[model samples]
Target chain A: MFDYLRYIRERNFPHIWCSGCGDGIVLKALIRAVDKLGISRDEMVMVSGIGCSSRTPGYVDINTLHTTHGRAIPFATGVKLANPKLHVIVVTGDGDATAIGGNHYIHAARRNIDLTVLLYNNYIYGMTGGQVSPTTPRGKRASTAPFGNQEPAFNISDLAEAAGASFVARGDVYHAQKLEKLIVKAVQKKGFSVVEILSPCPTAYGRRNRMAHPVKMMEWLRDQTVPVAKWERLSPEEREGKVRTGIIVDVDKVEYTETNDKLIESLKADK
Target chain B: MKKKRADNICMMQGNQACARGAMMAGCRFFAGYPITPSSEIAENLALSMPAVGGRFIQMEDEIGAMGAVIGASLTGLKSMTATSGPGFSLKQENIGYAAMAEVPCVVVNVQRGGPSTGMPTFPAQMDVQQARWGSHGDRGVIALSASSAQETFEQTIRAFNLSEKYMMPVILLVDEVVAHSTEKVVLPDPGGIELFNRKQPTESPGEYLPYRETDDGIPVLARFGTGYRYNVTGLCHDETGFPTNNPEKIEKLIRRLTDKIERHRKDITHCHKIMLEDADVAIFAYGSVARSARRAVFLCREAGIKAGLIEPTVLWPFPSDEVLETAEGVKAFVVAEMNLGQMAREVELASKCRVEVHRLNRVDGRLITPQQVVEKVREAL
Candidate 1:
């Protein structure tokens, strides 16, 4: 068994998440994936924006940067471009990635920079007391949306694909073991890779919706998602609310830093 | 016999000189969003950086640009970003974050006419106060200004130096006239230029404290991949670089952020003074307006109204003591700038009501002529 303690800052450990919050599950999966890859903690930089999920960096003992709200992708981009040797991973949430940071998200994908982004989609804003988020399902109740959320939810994995991410995948906290595998594959890929994990904000999101208990939220995740292989066999009508949990898009492209390095080399040769 | 100019001397635009200066300062990374009157700095670096094996990224937005600069700086690289008023406003939040986290980076703001998108193509010295107080906080700020292309180049290098020394963001305030103006600059040899880098901890990784206070109150920071696995956040953090709610620790951290700069005001403050001996009227100016003020000084003297000029390259930490001392001998001050009256207020405060201060302000997006400062000086006397 891999020792999770080696990767975590044990001193800062009375973790801030609620009992059933899936942030912990995602954190553990991320650690397991990193440990399996055998990447030294020193070479991995964990950059995060403001959210409960963003707090994951503080617990892990690597070179961590807790940056401003919605700016983690740009920050990670700089880190990667500055020292391509460092493996830059950005941890962000639905609101942090899709709403305030929507432009950066799409642009990073467009550049196809070498970044592995682990975005936690918790349906609602859990940090600032359960506000309606960009990923909040239409007609779901929230603090700001006392009346049901009238806005249509975003399919983030599809958004990444449309934005030109070299690799895009979806996973859920309920499928923790498989989620680790997905993260491993995303980190192993070259250009911009996005792994959107459907995590539960149990205290804030679950309490407002019908699934107040942590187990209930887990069960809901289990019911709403289908394996990619199984989902391909299902008809459009049969796939009503079920999301496919696997790689949605994967293709090869020249990474941004590599392209930039080539340009530098060509200029040197010309001189 | 006449002397020959060095082959390195060339007519370089202010923005291009500034970009070249960054490269000379060992800056390895630049991230910026295009804004009017300041886009050339980014454009020049976009081409020039690749030649030098440096990185230049045009980010999606101003906030992202600021964030990227800070991120690069933490990786132990000298980094910078340039912007105008509207973009500067968008960058304030992360600028504050850099101050709090003690990241060393340079932010260049080319002053333009504005409360909003006031004047893109025109010149104005409106960001003087904003450079000092733009970001929300009690954190210390160091801002430098330049009146010519040559000065802009030199100050760009100094901006990076101060940022690295203090481990905080330094603002390089340039006006549109200076940024776009072309002037002759004899680029210095790399060996002759003085540079500064952030202090790294000598302690082993286990004993390293990224925020541990030294004798100067500035903490040494370790680069990310150098085996120092520490946490850096915008939150109030302790010496170990992890967030803490302890009031004493928070108070110490906040005070040190400012005290580190304040204690070294002598080292950080820079002022350029001209012909004040046997003068009755002194002209206080900075950025491009100082060019007119210098001409006005000679014009005032030709008219037998003895005059001199005080041009501050370092605008913040305001050099109040020097101004206050100069105020004692001069009977009056003529404050010339492109804004309504930003630095004029500072002149008044520095003079402490002892000497009469008159303003020569222009907000019509035109230069304040030498005659205008002569008139303001006459009115002040």
Candidate 2:
């Protein structure tokens, strides 16, 4: 437990996250996952894009890059390939991953580039003062969505699965230990793995609505998520307003870098 | 120059020659996406790099390709990527980051016709301006153009040297025709060629600033594992590599980025002045078009027209002084390229005389022939 604390920058603590912001909880989960994996600090590269959740990398004491608004995946992929020994984890937000960087995220997944993407899906663009993001709920009220958001929220896990990601999981920050376990599985996965942690932005998404505190937000998450196995078992009324949580998909596939190296080697030998 | 080794001579396309040049220059990593005219580069690298103890990755896209090159470069490897027009446009942001962060890498733009996806399989030198100013802000660039397969090999080597020396990205401006066209190239042995690795700071990690300039205006870079914990950013940064809003620091940072190349103007600029000694007319060209211009100059000289050929190898920093010096005695300057008057504008800016600068351009996915260039030269005369 204390070892995990050493991986965190206490100076950056009491982070800009609000009192009830679930980003801090998600950060703890990531730290715990890294601790469990026992990967050396120097051998890990953490990349983040611009967002409330993206700030997770700054608080973590690792080889971290705070990149442009939507380029964390490419940066992380670079770090991974440059030194195949380094375990790369990209901490991105819903808006950061699925909006401007949507192309990169899908492509990275499609290549199955042995990266672990921890996407914090807060369902709104919480960093730029609560704009309507690609993952903003269709009728959610955000600063830019005064008349309620018209765009349907992205099912990011589904997108990742479709994009050939080997491992895909979703968990709510309200379920801290569960989120941590899923992250560990993601980190250990051979190919591209994504763990979408549905965290809460109390200051942005919460204050705008009635869920004003961490407790209320946790209650909302608890009410909203249904376990994947039990999803089909639920009645229509019971399934109402629930998002599926838990590992939605896991399949074996050859990773991008390794496959490319093999192909290059064979081609050279033939020549 | 030393005697060429047996392995140096290979009948290959210009793109393949580039790969061989990179290998000779000690480029250990290549990350690129397959785009037309540029695919041969990736194919050659993918086939040859690994055997030479290098690594090649076909990244998700050009954006990822650029990022991978920079990342690999940070680990103390010479790295490069090849792409065409649209992919080049996609890579602008990371290219800007590499510029501001002072990362040494090479970007090879095998030019293709495009406003957007115009001719994927055809040739155009449309990216000349984009190569200089495609990125968001003000920073100087090192660009090289090659007219033949042999020159492609030589210029690619020079691109790596400049990238490492200046700690900036070097652009190899190749076009579709040159990239895909095959020719016999004589590659020099590794021992005979001069390769440049970035100057690492001798100071202690704490005392070092990654972006800090020495008196000569080039920053010293330390590889990532060397325990030098310096920040690299796309934002305007100070000497310590930290983002700063200080007006003076911003001014100095921008000036140093540009001046590092400009101050070494004589050393960085390279061009071939053919038959300019007593010529009354000069034709300025670069890349494959220069090859055609060479033929044109030969025909003009036979016809009793004193036509010279000025082939600029260093396309950026624009060879302004050299162009001005060469244009002194000429009555007219005919700038021939495969695009709409890109290099012609530079010739006009450099010449002190009221010289008539004419442009012979081709955007029809075809090469500007020697006959066309000769006609332009005769008309200008």
Candidate 3:
């Protein structure tokens, strides 16, 4: 049994997440994954932006930076480049990662920088009172979309894969144990890795989407999500609404900081 | 860090001087986007940073560049970013974050004409008020301006020193004239200059408080990944650096964040009072316009007018005391700037109706000439 409580800031107790918010669950799985790797707490740095999931850094005891909205990835990029030895992790949400920050997200992947992005796809902007987000399913209800969201939703994992991330995976809060394992692999990958967690925002998202209870949201995850191995076997019609829950892409690439370091060294040698 | 030159005297452009001056000031991280009139600073740093064993990245946009600078600064590096008007607007949110979080860093805005990318390659002293109150919120700021390439070099170093000492972002504003003009500069020996680093906590990690108030009102920021394990946020946070909703705690945090900069205005403000000792008419200016103001002062004196120039290198914390003191002797002030009249309003407030304030305005992407200032002074008289 891992001593997860030791990793949290006890003084910040009574965490900010609502009774059934899935952010807490993602936080726990993240702690367990780091614990499994035997990494020192001091060696970890968590950077987050403004969102319900961005609050994850405040609870855990590590070098955490909660920055402005939609800028966590770039901040984390700086942190990683500043000290390549430290394992930098970015905790963000669907809107925070894909909307305002979409450019940075794609650019970081394109550069193949070493960062583990634990993106919480809650399907709505929960922190700002359940506004429509980039990941909001078409016809989903939101405060800004009371008449139902008119746009198609983004497949976040696919975006990361297309953007050239070295590692990409998806998991749900309902499968807590499996999610922890996936996070471990994403963190181990050398270049821009993304682990998109299908977390629930019970208060903001679930209530309006016909699953008001946290338990129902978890059940929705269980029923709608299929492992990628299984998902690949299903027909196109059979996979209409089902989400794939496993690694979609994993490959080796030249990490940005390593290349930067080499360039500095080569310049020094020439001098 | 390599010395600027063997003899320490060289002719360099204003942007080159700024980048080299930053190296002397121990800036180890730079992230910026390419914008006209300020792109040379980034281009110079891209070559210099790698040579000096520092880091540089051309970010995707202005906001991300500002964000990266803050993050790099938190990790105990003196980080900076340079941009122009449009980019400066995009960086305002993160600049506000640096203020609220008390992260020490530098932002250089090479003044270009703008309400919106109005003129990229030309100079304007338009961002004076914006530098002071650009970021939305009630927070005090420190901004410095330079009249020449040499002064831009020295002021860039001073900007970093003040930022580190005060634990906040310092804005270094240079106009397009100073940024692009080639001038002779005697670079100071790196060892001969003074530099200030952010205060490090002497206390153990267990006893450390990231936002604990000190005698000077500045809080010590522990570098990230150095066993401090502390949290930093833009939300109103208490001494522990965690967000709080208690009205009293929130108020205290806000006041402390602001008072740390406001209380030390004397040390942060820098200005040049040229020939103001005995003058009936004083010209108030800064940036490249200050060069023209100095010439106008000399021209006024030759023509039997007791005229002087009050050039504020530090534009914010607004030099009101200096203005008030100078206003006692001068009959009136001729405010010259490339903008319509930004600093003129500040001068009027500082003078407190003791002297009439006259304006010499220009916005056609041209530097205000000495003749224009002389005419304005004569007309006011």
Candidate 4:
């Protein structure tokens, strides 16, 4: 844990994230995961796109890339393919990952490259002052949705599973230790892995909805999420309105780099 | 790997020759998509890269391809990406990032007709302007246009050298005709060729700035995993690689980008000057059209007309000084290209002297033949 603290930029402490904001919690969980893996700090590369969650790379002490909006996955893919020795991680928000950059994210997962994506889903664009995001619940009030958000939110775990990610998991900020454990597992996995952390935006989404304090947001998260194993035991009615937090998908597949290398070798052998 | 002395002669397309050149130049990584005329380059790289312990990746699209090449270059490997006009357009943004980050990489744009997918199978040099201003911001680029398969091989080697020397992207502009047309080429002894690598910083990690300008206006590039802690960004940054909005810093940064090529103009720029000693008629051309103009110049001189050809090998810097000098006493100049009069505008800009510059334009997706150039020169005369 002390070694992991070296990766954090102490100058950026007391981050701009509002009190009880899920982003900080996610960041902490990520750090703990890195520490648990005992990966060399110099061998890590953190890439991010433009958004509140994307700012996570700026606080890390590794080879950090803060790229344009919604382009972090491609950049992370490039970094991984370039040097397979390095551990590449992407920290992106729902808007940055699922909206404009959705194409790249899906294709990257389809290839199943060795990359770990930490998606901080706060249900709104926190940096741009809480505009309705792709994951915002329908009928939720946002700055852009004065009345209520009418668009259907995406379930990221399902999307990752469908896109061929070898490892997919979801955890809320309130479940900090569980999130850390899942992140560690994803980092250790040898193919495309994504850990969706449902974070709270107290200032924007929480305050506006009158669940303004950190304690109330934590209470809501604790009550709204169910464990994945217990999810099947619960009746459909009981699980109807809750987010399931656990490793939803884990399987083995040939990674992109390894497959490409083998294909090239076979072609050369035939020649 | 050490280069061995050999003279292997073969009849191959210009694109194949480029692939051979890249292999000889120690390029171990190639990421590109298949596009008309330029697909042969990618295909050949796919077959040849593995033989030399290299890798080739056909990415999902040109954007990802170019990004992969940039990423590979940062790993201390020579890397390249090949594409045509539309694919080239998709690659421009990342090319700009490579430039701003001082990454050494090569981009080959085998030219084709296009506003959007104009001619897939046909030939055109319409991307001359895009090669200069395709990306968003102002940055220096080194572009070389090859006239034949032999030059294609030679220029590809030079492209790698320039990319490494300047820590910037070097464009190899080959029109569709030259790219696909077969010609007998004599392979040079690789042992005799010169290769350049990007200069590494001598300063300590804390003292180094990724974008710091040297006396020659070129910055030193440190490969990733070198413990150089220097930041790389697309934004306007100071020498230390930190973002800065200072007007003076921005001005100096842009100036360095421009001046690095401009200040070394004499040494970097290359062009062919023929029969300009006392010639009254000149034909300015490049790539396939330049080859046609060379033959036309011979025909014109035989007909008692003092005609000459100026073929620009370095396209981006425009070879302005040579163009101006070569056009000094000429009564008329004919600019022939496989495009809608792109380089003709540059010739007009350089040759400020009132020489009647007639353009022999061709956008019909075919090469501008020697006879057509001869006729245009005769008409201008």
* Candidate of highest DockQ: 1
lDDT of 4 by residue, B1-381 (tens): 988755588999999999999988888889898898799999999878876557787777788788778777876789999999999999998888888877889999998898899999888899998999999888887899999999999999999998998889999999888888899989878888898877888988768777776788888867666666544566787886655679999899987888888888887799888887778888999998888999999998998888898898999988888888877778988999887788889999999856878999988887788899888888988
Question: Per-residue lDDT for A1-271 in model 3, tens only?
Answer: 7788889988888888899998888989999999898889898999999899999999999899999999999999888888889899999999999999999999999999999999999999998899999999999999999999999999989999999999999999999999999999999999999999999988898999899999999899999999999998999999999999988899999999999999999999999
B159-232 in candidate 2: lDDT tens per residue? 99999988999999998888888889877766999888888889986587777668888888777656665545
The lDDT for every candidate, in the order shown, is 0.92, 0.85, 0.92, 0.85
DockQ (C-alpha based) per candidate is 0.87, 0.37, 0.86, 0.40
lDDT of 4 by residue, A139-193 (tens): 8889999898989999887998999999999998899999999999999999999
Question: What's the TM for model 3?
Answer: 0.98
Clashing pairs in model 4, backbone N/Cα/C closer than 3 A? none
lDDT of 2 by residue, A159-237 (tens): 9999999999999888999999999999999899999999988878887767878789889999999889999799889
Off by over 4 Å in 3: B1-6
lDDT of 3 by residue, B258-286 (tens): 78777898888878888899888989989
TM (B chain), model 2: 0.96
Q: For model 3 chain B, give the 10-residue run with minimal summed lDDT.
A: B1-10
Off by over 4 Å in 4: A1-5, A9-21, A124-133, A139-150, A202-220, A260-271, B1-7
